[model samples]
Target: MNDKPLSGRKAQAARNDKLILEAAREVFVADPEAPIAEVAKLAGVGISALYRRYPSKEDLLRKLCGDGLARYTELVREALESEGDLWGAFREFLRKVVVADTPSITVRLAGTFTPTSDMFEAAVAADELNRALLARVKDAGVLREDVENGDLALVTESVSSISLGDAERTRELRLRALELYLEALRAPGAGPLPSSAPSEEEMGARWVPKQAK
Candidate 1:
């Protein structure tokens, strides 16, 4: 009857939860509609255990996206506080986020499941951090006037689309593509980028689960 994690059963439960969540992140992002059994297989955990941890695919999706959002918010906060010139910090932030595939999580999995309250709060926090970081560069006269909040999301997602070959190869290509994007984002180079970024509302609507929307 001991519920302490020091107990073997409790420790196994914790390990199972971690495995299920990790597997869910990979399985769901690659294919959001993939069966729950697939996640269990990937995690090397029993299907019953995955269900015990998540109950439903929707629950799994929410947890995966929430964990991703929390990491993303922390990444943004780190970038904001990083020591460097404004432009340098901004560039490095974009690089690190792309490497983490943070933006790709929300981008790929949007509308797949309803987000929890914590997920919603994390998204807003990340948006605020992004805007604050952008503002710093804009105020310092380094960022282009046309750049907007949603632009970075699209940029990172674009690089994330490169899923050819192995993970190392994909990462190598993403970083290379990111350099091109970073150059475009840097100040005083290109004459006005064509078109406009969608409003955060326009983009954000997709992030809500279809049931909620």
Candidate 2:
């Protein structure tokens, strides 16, 4: 096998880019407003290399938002298309969206900005598909008839409502909370919920940490 200088450089550049991206995702999930230098440090790359790949923090966030949205939309699509029980599929969607890979970022960006054209389109598609899935569940008498799209949005946003403890414990706390919410959504023997819900301002206030702000 022969490795040309140009090809070698390109391969190294690709590897560095992946490392930077993965590091950025991890750092940002912990603190979205983390400095670019922090990401470079975590990636074990020079700041110059990080900047060469992503010119600025906003640029990196834009890329992450687009990529996250695309992946999330695909998850919903796969769940809907899978040849399995409708209720199980719906629960899986809830579980993944709430607690799966990079969920903190996804939740942070939920119903927020469309950083790019592709992201905008993906957001629209995700919303439409989400509604369709909920409709199917409602029609099948699995989920309650009152479970509107807003209910799902509320549930997602609720992830930000409370902080049980440390970052390491956050996922466990969120999953436990989600399980309670899921049980409440069941069609049969469901109890009444409070007439009022949390406001966007309130949820937004809690979503990001004070340091990140």
* Strongest candidate by lDDT: 1
* Candidate 1 structure quality by residue, lDDT tens digits, 1-213: 976556798888988888888888888888888999999999999888888878998888887777778777888898788765878878777788888887678777899877777777777888999899888788888888789888888898899888878999989999999999988987876798888897888887997777775
- Give per-residue CA lDDT, model 2, range 88-182, as digits (tens): 88888877876655456766544333255665576678878877888888878889876666677678667645567776587788878888898
TM-score: model 2 vs. ground truth = 0.76
TM-score, each model?
0.91, 0.76
Angstrom error at residue 88, model 1:
2.2
The lDDT of model 1 is: 0.84
The superposed Cα distance between candidate 2 and the true structure at residue 181, in angstroms, equals 1.2
Highest TM-score among the candidates is held by which one?
A: 1
